[model samples]
Target: MTFVIQLMSGLAVGCIYGLVAIGFSMIYRAMGLVNFAQADIMMIGAFLGYAILVAAPGIPFWLAIIGAMLGAALLGFVIERVAIRPSVARRADQVYLVLLTLGIGIVLSNGARLIWGADPVVYPTGLTHQTLTLAGYPLPAVYLYIAVVMPALLVGLHLFFTRTWLGLALRAAADDPDTAATMGVRPALATSVSFALASAIGAAAGVLYAPISYVSFDMGVIGVKAFAAAVVGTLGSIPGAVLGGFIIGLGETFGGQLIATEYQDSIAFAIMIGILLLKPTGLLSGARR
Candidate 1:
């Protein structure tokens, strides 16, 4: 029973990593540039959700998630237009653009510190400690929430990318901007939309994760593990991102139980390194972006 509970907990954490990794993969696929600030966007979303809950103590958790998503999406659009688009227009070097994202991330983290303070904050709700009886066993309510949310998100994303016009246009633009433009698919708009969608997803991860842990500006460090998941799954493949996330999540969880809690982070990276050694391009090397 303990093992089962630990497994579920790991899966929930993995889902969060997968969600953030999807953001990294999407931005890379659409813009061919890694936005290091992607994690900071998640931090911002967590903060936004915190603010929403504080403002409306009676609001549903799901509603708070949506509010965070929309707020983060708007922020993503503004960042793309004001910072990323101009750099692309000027044909900035890839290194410079990556550095720019790092700078932006630093600014965001520090700015958050100024606004929300350096101290970590916990959710005001009791869901953090709530448990549900399932299969004659008790499990954290947040785990159930994650299990439902992750699958729903995957399905929604699949439908959006497969059945929607804007989604198709975004794919075309990412594949070939010039050809897409001739077909009336604006690359710039696609890029902006991609960032917004990615940011929204990252925000969702933040909101879901908040119930399990304290929210802090430095929480973005979890992004490092998520990045490893992206690389292990294949940098631009959505399914791969999720797969890698689960692998890291489960591995670290069991490892911590069998080995030591202090080695959990190391176990995640070690798994990444081991996988990379065996499959240089990632487990889904030839998979689509």
Candidate 2:
């Protein structure tokens, strides 16, 4: 029962990682460039939700998340249009693109620090202060909520990609921009939408995460784990990202519990290194560019 409880908690955290990783996958799929700012955008989303909740104490938690998603989406769109597009247009080197994103991430993290200060902010969890018991152990409702929510979101996304016109276009664009453009899809618009989607999804992860963890300007460091998940699961693969997230999350929790808590972060990095050494393309990369 204790093991089960810990697993549940780890899975809840994994859900957040998976959500953020999806954002990474989306942008990489569309633009073939990793957005270093992905995690910072998530941090921005968490702060946005916190701000909304603070301003209107009566607002629903879900509503606050929605607001954060919208705000992050807009931010993503603007950044793509103003910063990324210009770089692509100039035919800059891949290294330059990487540096550009890294700079954007630094600016965002510092800007957030300037606004919210460096302290961690507490976030509200709408769940009751009660725990549900199964066998001899108790589990928080937050864990159950997250488990359900994450899978549901993933399913919805899968359906959207398989069933919707825009989603198909996005997929087509990601698979091959030239072919997609020849099919009358607007590559620029699709790429912008993909960035917006990635930002919104990342922000949603932040919203979910803020409830369980402290929100801080420096919280963007968690992105390191999420990015590792993306690589381990295979960049540009949604399902792969999700699987990588669960693996990392579970490994961290189990390692902390059975080994040393102080080395929890190291556990994830080790797993990433192991996976890369074993399979450079990742567990689920399979033919994806």
Candidate 3:
């Protein structure tokens, strides 16, 4: 029963990592660069949602989530236009772009600290103060919300990629920008759209996770674990991201259950390393199509 409870808890948190991994995968697919600030952007979303909850007490939680998503998406677009695109235009070294993202992460983290203070803030989950019982064990209702939200979001993303023209174009641009340009797919627009989508998804993850864990400026460190999940599942594969997330979640929980809590976090890295040694391209080989 305890194992089950821990597993459920891990799954709920893992879903957040998977969502962030999706952003990492999408941005990497389109731009060939990781937004080191991806996690910080999620922190921004948490604050935005918290602000909405405080400023407009009557506003629905769902509506506040939308506001956070929009804010994060706009921030992503601005970053792409102002920082990434200009550097790309100048044919800057990849190291410079990577450094730029790292710098942006620092700026955003410190800026958040300045505004919110260097303290963790508890978010009001608004979930019922109730627990569902299974096998004589109780689980928080918020777990159900995370479980439901993750699948729904993934399905929406799959539909966007497989059914929509713009989605297909974005995929094409990611696969081959020069070829996509000749085929009338605008690489610049696709890049901007990818960043926006990634940021929105990251924000959604933040809102979902903030309820489970306290929101703090330094919480973006989870982005590293999510990146491990991304690499474990296959960096550019959407389905892989989902698989990798659950694997990491389950592994950490199970490892902690059998071993020690102090080493729980290291389990994800061990799995990542073991998997990478066996499959360099990731467990899933093909990129998202």
Among all candidates shown, the one with the greatest lDDT: 1
What TM-score would candidate 3 get against the native?
0.95
lDDT of 2 by residue, 72-162 (tens): 9999999999999999989998899989988999999999999999888886545535477756678765566576668777888888889
Mark the regions of model 3 whose C-alpha exceeds 4 Å error after superposition.
Answer: 128-130, 134-136, 286-288
Better by TM-score, candidate 3 or 1: 1
Give lDDT per model, in order. 0.90, 0.87, 0.85
Alpha-carbon shift of residue 106 in model 1 (angstroms): 1.1
lDDT of 2: 0.87
Ranking by lDDT: 1, 2, 3
What range of 10 consecutive residues in model 1 has the weakest lDDT sum?
A: 136-145
Worst 10 residues of 2 by lDDT: 123-132
Q: After superposition, how far is residue 92 of candidate 1 from its true place, in Å?
A: 0.6
Each candidate's clash count: 0, 0, 0
How many clashes would you count in candidate 1?
0
All-Cα superposition RMSD per candidate: 1.1, 1.8, 1.7
Badly placed stretches (over 4 Å) of model 1 are none
